[model samples]
Target: MSISKKTWLLIIAFFCVYVFWGSTFLWNKMAVKELPPFFLASIRFTSAGLLVFAISIATRKSLAITRKQLLNCTLAGFLFLAYGNGVFVWALKWVDTGFASLLASLQPLIILLMMRVIQRKKLQWKSMVGVTLGIIGMYLLVSQKDIISKEGMVIGILMILSCLIAWCSGSLFVAKADLPKNFFVATAYQMIAAGVILVIASLCFQEPWKSPLVWQDNTQIAIICLILFGSIAAFTSFNYLLKHVSPEKVTTSSFVNPVIAILLGWYFLEESISLQTGIAALLLLTGVYFINSRKRDKPVVVAKTKV
Candidate 1:
């Protein structure tokens, strides 16, 4: 059967988000070797934010928003983009890209728990099973001998988990907050706010002047790729898919990303995946599938709108 053009576009968006986002772990690892973690993250989000904001202006997207909306966006930016991406980069300093990606894959699981606690909603059976499996997976992945040998691995893991929590919390906040009706305007403002905050943080934590300008190396290429594909393309495609498809389906990208990251890490970084990693991947993916699988209730339909 021939799919409609809109369906095809959604498919393309899904591919971009799932594949590009999965590969970001590799790029992040490469970028952090030369660039300080927070600074690299700051530059990445800032550049992407500026680019998207400029495009929004060129396209005549409205910039006007309430102070309350701006405040909500600022909170989201600090938590999700700055702290979330920041901690992921910092974790890369100690962990392999594959393992880091594996750990990051726990985001969905974290979100599930957060929802239950904050919303005071009872957990579904499937969700409980999923969370259990995910926790097991995390244990297996973190218990690796190589990971243990890495100095500061524990700290890195904690940082990455903290990042996950912050990101998830920010996501819930955005969902509940009063924001602009326009997704495009809201996203643009959030990116701009996040970029500005990251810039100030980067300046405070990292003296960019004293840091050698090493943009001429392979790491620069990685950073460029991160900014372009990971930040810009990934976010754009993700936002697009949210407009066209079910959020649950769009979120399936999370489960798919870890597998791809593991394979890519094995291929590009020569990182060896152990039996434990495979088992953990299985458990985590199984759990995620259960948690995100169709709900008995009718799915909510989000109307088509420009972002």
Candidate 2:
């Protein structure tokens, strides 16, 4: 059967988001060793945001917006980037990359609960089942002997959970808010706002300059990769995918990211992948599949406009 061009585009967009975002955990791990977490995030987002903003202007993309839209974007930036990603970076100091990814994958479940509570959306049975499976999987993943002995594991887990919750809240808020019709412009605003907030926070809380500027060759390479692929490519593709796909489909990134993170951890960091981690991965993947596999009676259409 021949798929429509829109379908093909959607598929490609999804592939970009899934694969690029999945590898972000590895890049982040590499960056945090040499760069202070918030400082690194601030730099990554600021660089990407400026690049995209310049492109938008050059291309004559609509940067004009109402005060309400600006406010919404700013709030989302604080929630999603400053707090969500900021907490994620902080958590990595203690959590293994695989474990951090697994914990972060709980965003979908958090989104479900948030929707039910705030929007009065009814809870679906599949979501409940997915949440249960995910929780079980997290238990299996974190209870490993090697991971449990870490001094700050509990704090890391809490921070990661907070990250997931903050991200979900930001996502839901953005979904409901009146924002730019152009995804790229909206994303640029969000990133810029986030970068500003994160930079300020980093300067005040982290005092990143006081830390030795020792950049190992590997760390420098990792920083470059993180800024390019993790910040610019991954996030831009993600926002692009959202323009073409359903929110449910977009959430699949969370599911894919964990599996990629686990594999990368094994390959790059020489982290041990126990049977429990494998089982947890399987359960999480299964849950995500079931959650996203529901049939859509209507075809999704994409506008031919460029962001």
**Considering every candidate listed, which one attains the maximal lDDT?**
1
Q: What's each prediction's TM-score? A: 0.90, 0.86
Q: In angstroms, give how far residue 226 of model 1 lies from its true place.
A: 2.0
lDDT tens per residue, model 2, 250-305: 76675677778888988999877777878988887766655555443431211110
The lDDT per prediction is: 0.76, 0.73
Clashes of 2: 0
Residue 199 of model 1, lDDT score = 72
List, residue by residue over 88-188, the lDDT tens digit for candidate 1: 78788888777887777777678778877887766778878989999898888888877688898999989888888887787777767888887767776
How far is each candidate from the true structure, as Cα RMSD in Å?
A: 3.6, 4.5
TM-score of model 2 vs. true structure: 0.86
Clashes of each: 1, 0
Candidate 1 — which pairs collide?
184-307
